[model samples]
Target: MEESQLERNRRNGFLALVLRPINWLKMLGEEVHWSFVIGVMIVYGISQGFAVGMSKVSTMYYMKDEQKVQPSELQVYLGLLQLPWVIKPLWGLLTDTLPVLGYRRRPYFIFAGFLSVTSMLALSIQRNLSLAFSLLSLIGVSAGIAIAVVAIDACVTQNSISHPSLAGDMQSLCGFSSSIGALAGYSLSGFLVHLVGPKAHVDSIPSAARLYCFFSSFYPLHNLSGVTLTSQGVFGLLSVPAGLVILVGMMLKESRVHKFTHRGVNEKFLDAGKAMWTALKFRDVWRPCLYMYLSLAVSLNIHEGMFYWYTDAKGGPSFSQHGLFASKNSNLSLITYHEISSWLNSDSELGCSDVLFWYGMQEVVGSIFSVGAVGSLSGVLIYQNWLKDHRFRDLLFWSQLLYGASGLLDLILVLRLNLKIGLPDYFFVVIDEAISMMIGRIKWQPLLVLSSKLCPAGIEGTFFALLMSIDHVGLLSSTWVGGLLLKFLKVTRTQFDNLWVAILIRSLMRIIPVFLLFLIPRSDPNLSILPEEMLKMKKGDNTLESENTEMVSLVDST
Candidate 1:
């Protein structure tokens, strides 16, 4: 009988391999409701991941080409967009304590969807909006995304509590959905921009007429008859995610909450504040929290300055909205290519002379984003497999070191040092993006784990939200500081001579966080960082405990 069983196992190995995924899917369906699964995919996967990736590329191009915002000012405006995330705790609290039309999650999700859809539609259809309005529209979009994320996070938290054994699996599902959606979104961003063209057509006077005016030569004039989609059209497509979000709201299985009292809500808020204050009094909690804030604040995000340089610098490989590639050494080659394309257009009576000039060129920036997505996912895998068990202090120290080291790639790219080293601009940027994203993700993973570890027992939800908000505040601070740095260095729309200096400053500041490593706990992750008394709240504390046991589940699931 043993021999027969061994033979059967050997024969079914290939079949088992094929059925494993099917079996996993079956188990997932049994463990989690289908509505919850779909809601997560739409919220995290489409709204957060795909829409965000596409929006980043489109917004940069719009601000740079249409709004004409300089790198320094753009940095400030970009920072403003993060305001919603900085106040994420408020959104979480509202979802927890306040319900509209007797529904908590569904109303917020629907409102988020409505907000996102309107903002995206506004951006897409309106061509000549003022800079202030454009920024406001973008902020609205950001707010919508943030609200939806908070709502979905609340759902995840509730489910984690209801099904304790499936908490890890649920988190994994969320992470995987986000990563895969991000990868597809980023990989397609540049191609879609290139295909749709990054900017609306400016009504330029025919070049023939201008030449005729200057040279008094009889140049033939022809109307541009070719039609192409613009970046606005791409933005219009982003409405798909918002539409899905609305559907998720309508389809989500949530029971009606018929009870409400303003006094009760106020008391809950007071309890949450008191609990958070109590948790922060613990040195074990506040130390790491302070470190997390400092680590992010000191990094100094100068991405706008670097982005403008990447697309506009003469001596560097250019990555632009239109299929643009320019380098100091390749000017003649580019001119030749343009002239050849022009000649081809001359032979075609139906085509515009300049329309096809950039044909077949790659959207280099979008491709870099795509590559970075892969790197981020790889970082997640690496941490899960190897680094998840490491002591927090050691893991953070090496990741920070590598993070600072990898930042030098930006300096190299800015200085055109990669070209001197025989590596082309496009190839080098891809490698740099991948490495930087991987290191950044690695640095962030430990911080997330640490944040989860630090959350106290009863008020886990509110405290965790507060911690996330602190991180966003740090991000806001970093962005604003980077903008000031760029302004101080005189980096401008066409002037990038000092951009390298800004990069150097940022890279150097990335190392400052390393010295603050003393603030992090050196204990293994398996051990609780909090004291026993803190973890064990009095049984009589019903207000905070009853309400937030579900909330802390969100932390553990993360």
Candidate 2:
């Protein structure tokens, strides 16, 4: 029988050789696939729902509902809401690496979900929201969630070793699951207030346009008099989904795998210390990490931050005109993403949107399809081609560079539109996003897989969690960073014209990190080692290789 990496560790440290249930289960039937899809669905459903739902209420649903808040205030509010997530890395380290109930990863994950559900429920009870309560609610939900994310990523990474070859596919399918959750959550949350009205549709265009004035929520109240008129008072109700996921998770024949797991005081400390040291030692790793962080930061910033411009702020190509165009463009992208990938990519009419909702959805759809068809496949092709002499260092580098350039493409698209320069700005933005997603899909999973392969035995979960934690901080930053940049753009709630410079500056900032990706070692320091020899090689520690490893981590541990 083959001595796996863990078995090899017996010679290194008694505690290091202990094999968890996860390893045996890897040989079991690959049932984790369903859980992954569902888990991801729940994750995206809740996480993204929180991210976008608040914005929807402020931008569309609650606009007329709250008079005290102006577009300016909402602009700042959107930026402020992400503050908890910005520091989420700290939260992850708290529950993940630390102990609770004598269990490190499990207890925190369970409690994290509970807090998430409770936070959602609490927020829903408050129909009348103040900035303080809202921020608190956001924080509570996000805090629990930040912890949940780390746990989920760790679990997924461990679970994934079973079908290790499918890591990329696993990640891609997870994307779809997340999309399903987002679209489902977004679509349903508004059903009560926006779709079926307590009152019938009003006659005439003006009355129809202002129909929000007459609708009432499921929760009855006299104050609801003009409640539906403005989306001002809506609660995210993210708890509903959280509750559902919890129930479903309970049915998941518990991951008894932890039972086989062994962790001694000294062993765990060394594991964590070694992992942390390795994380810091890898230049190639951090390079891609930095690029990803900044890219997502800018993309999301442009996405959420620019909405004020699309709405009443810049007053783009008239709401009606922009709406029709944007609607058409979005529809096109959505079809291209989900439908066409099913081999249905036919020539068709494109749509555009003035509404942030549809435009954003369009981008989401584009990214999904790109990930599966073009992006993942492209990276796989590159990897396959590199099977000869190891050149993935360049592959990884170029992939990241392309993603950065895609960011630059965003600026170019906006410039073209702003200057009435070439093709429409939407064209540039949409294509840029698609390419970005493609490169992103290609770049990220390889990085993760490489990390896992190279990590010293016994510290897989801890180190994997750390990598994800860092990337997420970057993801969170994407949400608010654009808003900060927009503050300087000051183009206004009415004039849509002069803010291209912000895009340019952000793109330039984003590009700087791509060059840094070169700092990562070009090869896996551990894959070359046999399972028997692996334990002796501490995870996060590098092995010197003769395979022409242009990109490698380190032989040193913190």
Candidate 3:
């Protein structure tokens, strides 16, 4: 009887370990509000996931293969696309202060959906790089999805004041929903690239225009498989989610205050401007903003640029017949080719399409079993369970350090150091991506938590938007600076002799931001308004009410 019991216990324990993630997800689902979960799913899943996925793959191959643009030149155009995100304060201001047809959030949501659909449709049909850049920027403006996210987040944050525990649960939902969206996008992007293959070259301008028109109107069937999966088809499919977003927007029920504020459009604009100005003048608000900007500006991300060059470059670890080459400079020397070639052998060079296909496969496998998904899920669980009591500053510092350390994997892969231990190139690539993504997700949770704590009541959307915009600017700056570094180092598709130097510089730069941790506040993660601050906000609300009453009286008298 004892032996039978022990055997049964071991079997149950093994099954539990296998099903732990599903159980965690179920627990999380029960903890969060259903409406919040649904809102995040729609906003992140369809809008952010589908649109971003299609754009990334399409833009990358379109420029690299069709236009034959260099990595540095391509990064500049990508940076230009980030302009809409950088000026997100304007969107926040418009939505916060101004009402459209007696609604603040719904109208913008509809506009964003429509704009996204049109821009994506245009991108699918148009092959002009310049035109593509313009469309990309326009899509950025149609980011009504973000507005919806901000509005929902504000609601959750307000509720958290009374229910402190709800804050972490909601943040977890946001991160989890976002990861789901990203995984879907990442998986589809590569598949689409493989399906579309490469854009054909045309002799005349008119002929190219005609070709685009044909593709726009109808997808050409693939000769080998007799399947229709043109670039236009893929983009058109992506636009369906945007259409769904518009439907969701149309169905949203606005609050009474949102409807009440509808009486004064112009007045709301002035009020919004004033509110933004006031928020900016506050030391607490501006200090974090300044710190985030400065830290992001100095932080380097040449790794992405270098990765592209390394993968596509001939004679690199992935393709070079003679594994690793010795660098004349001691700083560049790491691992030898012979050491790597023992387990990993490169037979041939990979074309652009081949590279994209491999990436897609990696994304697909990574989505299913990668540390990224596991780590993201784990992060939410850890924060909600164990780390909720920990200080934001301390969590952020440690996570950032781990994230920076993950950068070393890129260097190892570049130098074929992983192969020394009998790991295949593809295995190393997947592992590196998983580790980096896991740490990256861990780092993201605290920022969202902190942002929720920092937002004031009245201008929550605008303030959060401003904070998110600053974060995006940091990302954009990284891309732009990385491009410049790549160009300056002469790290091209065929040339990567100085790639190590750029990677080393980026790694060192990642560490510098850790020292500036003093800029962040060490207060409670659930920091809410003090009694005095709440009183001030109540008075401001009263003043607004009085002003509206006076205006109504004047209108009635007239």
Candidate 4:
């Protein structure tokens, strides 16, 4: 009898495991509209895949190899592209407070999609586009994504509020979609780049040439006298994701807003602004906000410098697009920095012959990114199951400490120390990437949860946007400071003697936030961060009636 009972229990557990995914899908279908699910998949999953996996990688290579952009300059340009995100509050406020042509969320999605599609198409089709024009186009694309992100976040937040019981499931679905999308996109990125090439035929200019044309006029469209770099068809594929964003807008079901008045709009903005300001005055709110900002800013984002060093440095392993890990059947030999330099000096025939080899190397990096996506999902699970219950201060202190320690892997990779430990560069890099990505997601997850708990009832959207904007501001600061550090250290495109020093400095700076853990509340995740009065103020804010319930959740959902 005992043996039979144990067998039945074992069978039941196995069946439960097999049925979990189906249960998840059923719950999602029952909880939210089909259109909402589709919108989330496209916005969170597919968009992330294209942006990170394909567009980001291709653009970096295009700037580096074709345009000869210095590491510092690239950092600045990329930071500038994130301008729209830094002011996400504006997008959030507009979406929540104002309706366009009688519709709110749907029209914004349409606008975002249209803007992204236009920018990508222009970038792909233009043959001799100027450097400034290319940068602006990329910025436009980013703006579109940012707007769409704000809208989707609003949707998720509203759903979470309405279907409080299924909030966790909805959040999970969103994260899963993003993770799977990123994995698929990154897995295919290198192959796509290999097939299409990374270069674009932009008229390159001198680094010292000021892009005043961007502000003054569009007259200087291209420098015809400048060298025409290698062109690729990869840029054309970017339009597909943007087009899907449009489909998301069309598919999303939203009721028409019949109310309209300029005075009402002003009143809504005023109320949101007042509520946001009020929330900031609380020590619990402002202290953590300040800590989050300093933590991000001090970390310093010297990724561009590191990327150049990875691919171009003569003193290090040149993990170029074509040569790091050569397959057995490949005609080209495994290339080092010396070989890469010589190949560049060789004729077009030699370069053309090596394209396949270059793509094989790129695949290794793409695989690393794909692995990181899985690592990120693992992080979410680990946090949800274990760390979510811990006190905020303790959780952050240990995570921040570990975060700094993870930087040592990059240092080890750059120094080729793994080779001494019998680890191949490819194997070591993949592990390093996965571990770092997992730790990063873990560290970021708590802050997102904390941010959500801090949101007041009526002004959730506006105040959350304000908090996110603070975070973006920190990111902008980090990017600019990293650029300055690279320039100051003279870690240019080819010169990487001081690369390790920059890495060491960044790692040390990441540890500085550990000392600021006192700013975080000691309360449990279940406790509200805001004061009781702030929570109770939901009744009086009539101006924010239409806007308050649908606040943004950009980071929280991810």
Candidate 5:
């Protein structure tokens, strides 16, 4: 009886541990009254997840498998696609400064959703590589997903100024929702990509014509069966999130005051331009922004291209030993694909799709059970419970250092050093991903918290958008630089001889940002300045002047 009771107690403890984060989010949602802020976040989170998953699967697998595009060339296209995100400050300016039909947020949200849906649909049917690239880039631009996200963030930041205790909790909820969405999307993406074979194989029709036919009619009608899911069909299904974004835009309630501004369009644009200039002039805001940019600028991600090359290389260990273990062990079947079409193709050349499949498996497992999910959750908890009081700069430095350390695992794998220690490629990837994800969460949460605190009054959305855009610039630059490095090193699908050189350069680059930590604030702004004190600080700020009267009127009306 006592043993049974102990077992029951253990089970209860496990359940409590699992449900704690969910409960926290529930409490936060109720406290926030499930307002537009929370609603926007949830919808945006899911949409962002779906978009990221779609991009990853399509680029890494479909493009490689179908188009036979080399890694170097693909990287170039990926970098080009980031242009919209890099220029996101323009979107911020337009959304914040210009109102459509007297509504700033709603109309933009609707337009963005419409664009995203249309872009995804176009991607489904288009067989031309140039057109596909253009559509993908259009998705990044028109999705205005970032616009919605930044707007919600601005609302949260404004609310946080008044309710200081809820600031961290609200940010936690945002991260939690985003993580959930990403995990779900990633899981579904793997399944979808696997279901849709890497390249469409039509015996009768030419590949291009068949692709058009599948996307135009066959996919939508669900005519294809068993291991014949078309890429266009998957893309068609992926459009559902954009539809949800449109629904959210139409249904979400916003303040009527947000509907009308006393200023003329010219005045609004002038004020926005001034607001951006004033915000950048502030040491507190632009300092962190500069730091984030520099840190990201110096960071190298050449390892990503290298990893793909390593996996797909014809003579590589992963390639040579692909079927050896699976042939001997029945248990291996549980982890890998079951269908014969999944592993075999007519050409008999080792297909890149198989490598992508296993990689997806690693990603799904790591995202759900191993590191990405658990680590991200724990990151929020750890920050809230133990590290919230600590210096933000110190925490960021440590987290980034740990993140760089995680890259060493990739280096080890690239060097085939893991094989010497009897670590299979699969285990190394899964473990490395788990660790990297956990550290990544730790690194990212503080950055978001800092960005939230840095938003000045009156122009919170515009300023936050600028900050995010700057961050994207860093990412965009990194992607472009990584692609350049691959091209320079001549790292291709077959030739990875110089891959380690690129990896070494990236590893060294990751540590350069650590030395530049002086740019980040040493203290948490929310705690450092009391709410009343913050109001005092804002009194002399010019950017807050244009909207002050309207905000005051809105407050009085409420």
Candidate 6:
């Protein structure tokens, strides 16, 4: 009977491993989770676009000095002003972890929505304000949207962790929603921007020598200039939909997400502090956290490298001149398939929001290719029972090493591939991007899973928020370092071939963390089961002794 029970338990464990969470939406009838995800995506996608349009683009076109604004002036002004976004994570950690009305995800979503919407409305009102005031106003709008973004991310992260089965569906919905936002905003921005003519024809000047005629064709040849850079930094237009989706999603009555009910009382708000301390106490946490930061830094640097590559090697001319903007509107750009005007407009205004929007677009292509990156994790989810037999550390180590190798391979593609044709280079870029995404999926998901499992039942939400904070810090740090690094590298549009070196350095950063991966404590299978079976054995031993004593008494009576 004992052997039979043991065999049955082993079989049950095997089934558990094979059926871990991935299709949570499908399991829940595709109604609740999927609908909510889609609805929020649309709302936020639209909101994100609006946010960019009102704050960044409008501010750019607000008219400077009455003698048509120069792109350089706006660029210089924005360069100094966009610093608020980098520190947003610090405040984000606060809002996400604190509960406003006896719930974690609900109240925060409402606040974020309110801030995001109100800020945009205010910006639209002050569209033609003075330069200093306009710059300040843009910062205000950025603050509101930035706060809202982290709050919404908090919801998705916590929700998915609670329902592991829904991880894949959640990520898919996110992809669809983010991509929609990017597509709509980018496509629209090109057409609506304030047009600056490329020609500068002065009525008083003689036609013999037009001073700016040699500068760019974006301006009329004899007229000297007709183009104008028509923007502030409306980049948020691309991501506004993401925020709108989350805002409306506050309508979702937090699903019955029942694994263990997280502690949600009014007094429980202080747990965020506890979660922070808990995470910090574990020296082991730093190993992977370092890896995450290093990887993001490398990715950002590569992005900078690519920007230089496009300007110098792939595309002709520098953005410092006005003619390029005219060229962009006249179908002289790479993304001509979609007629996105402001993105390439001669006088475009951009905000930091544009960086995030483009990043989201890149992630879409990357997510599709990350299946191999998380292959081991998928196997673990699919064959969870085998995990009882296998060591968790082994799984983690192998996954990180594989990811590291993929990063290196990406470098090779950039350097060695003698793609005489642009199509071949594009193909390699896609592959490299896919590999990078795959490794990220594999590496990052595990961090969430481990934290979710290890966190004490009562403080799960707060603990989860704390983990997210660490993740954000990693990203924020990368942004800071990337800015300085780009400035230092002087990585210009002219030096395209040197991008391979950037790729190689970025790939190499992953190596240091590979050694640290093994230090993390593996999940203990022994603790996850019921102790009632052992208790039953102890009870059975006393009953057998009592029966034996009864038998002895009967024999003595005989």
Going through the candidates in the order shown, the clash numbers are 0, 35, 1, 4, 0, 58
Per residue, candidate 4 scores C-alpha lDDT tens digits across 275-354 of: 88878888898999999999999999999998887777776556663344232345635654344444444552432323
Q: Which regions of candidate 2 are displaced past 4 Å?
A: 1-41, 44-106, 160-164, 183-193, 196-237, 255-275, 282-300, 313-315, 318-392, 395-456, 475-484, 495-497, 524-558
What lDDT score belongs to each candidate, Candidate 1 first? 0.71, 0.45, 0.58, 0.71, 0.59, 0.41
TM-score of 3: 0.75
Q: What are the per-residue Cα lDDT tens digits for candidate 2 across 1-558?
A: 467766766666654335432342243325553344445545555554333433343333243234344333454565555555555545544433455544455565566667777776666566667767766766676676666565555555554444455544445444444444444443344343343222222221122111111111222212222223323223434455555444433433332223222344345455556655765565544554565465455544465334444333333321111211123224432221122222213333331122222222212222223232343344444443343134446656566566656666655544444446545444444455556655665666555555444333344455556656556566656645655566556654554465677666665665565555554556542233114343343322231111100101111100
Looking at model 1, the pairs that clash are none
Q: For residues 1-558, what per-residue lDDT tens digits would candidate 5 score against the true structure? A: 999999999999999999986786677656555453346454546677545545454445555555667776776666666666666666666666666765556666677777777777776767654746754644453345665565465567666655666777767667766666665565465456545534433333223221101121123111121222235656667677777666666754454434345465566667667756866777776788898888777776564475465447653443212321133223343222223333343454543322321222322322333235555556766776776666778888888888777777777877889889988766676677667767777777777777777765666666667777788788777877887898899888778888878877886788887888888877753562323333332333223332311111111211
Which 10-residue window in model 2 sums to the lowest lDDT?
545-554
Q: Which window of 10 residues has the lowest lDDT sum in candidate 5?
A: 209-218
Top-scoring candidate (TM-score): 4
Best-to-worst order by lDDT is: 1, 4, 5, 3, 2, 6
Residue 91 alpha-carbon offset, candidate 4, angstroms: 0.2
Q: Which pairs of residues clash in candidate 3, taking residues 3 or more apart in a chain or in different chains?
A: 324-337
Tens digit of lDDT per residue, candidate 6, span 1-558? 999999999999888756643344345435334444544354334454333422332343343322233322333444444344455445544444343454444555556555555554454444345666656655655555555555444445445444544444444444334434444443334333322212133333334322211111112223322233334324333234434434453554542222222344222334445544645565545554555455444443344344333223433222222221123224322232122323333244542223211111111222222323233234333333343233345655666676667767555544544354444434465566555554554555445444443332233334444555555555655545554454455544344444565556655665566665555556442222112221121112111100000001111211
Q: Candidate 5: where is the Cα deviation over 4 Å?
A: 1-19, 36-41, 128-142, 194-230, 258-263, 317-385, 528-558
Error (Å) of candidate 3 at residue 289 is 2.3
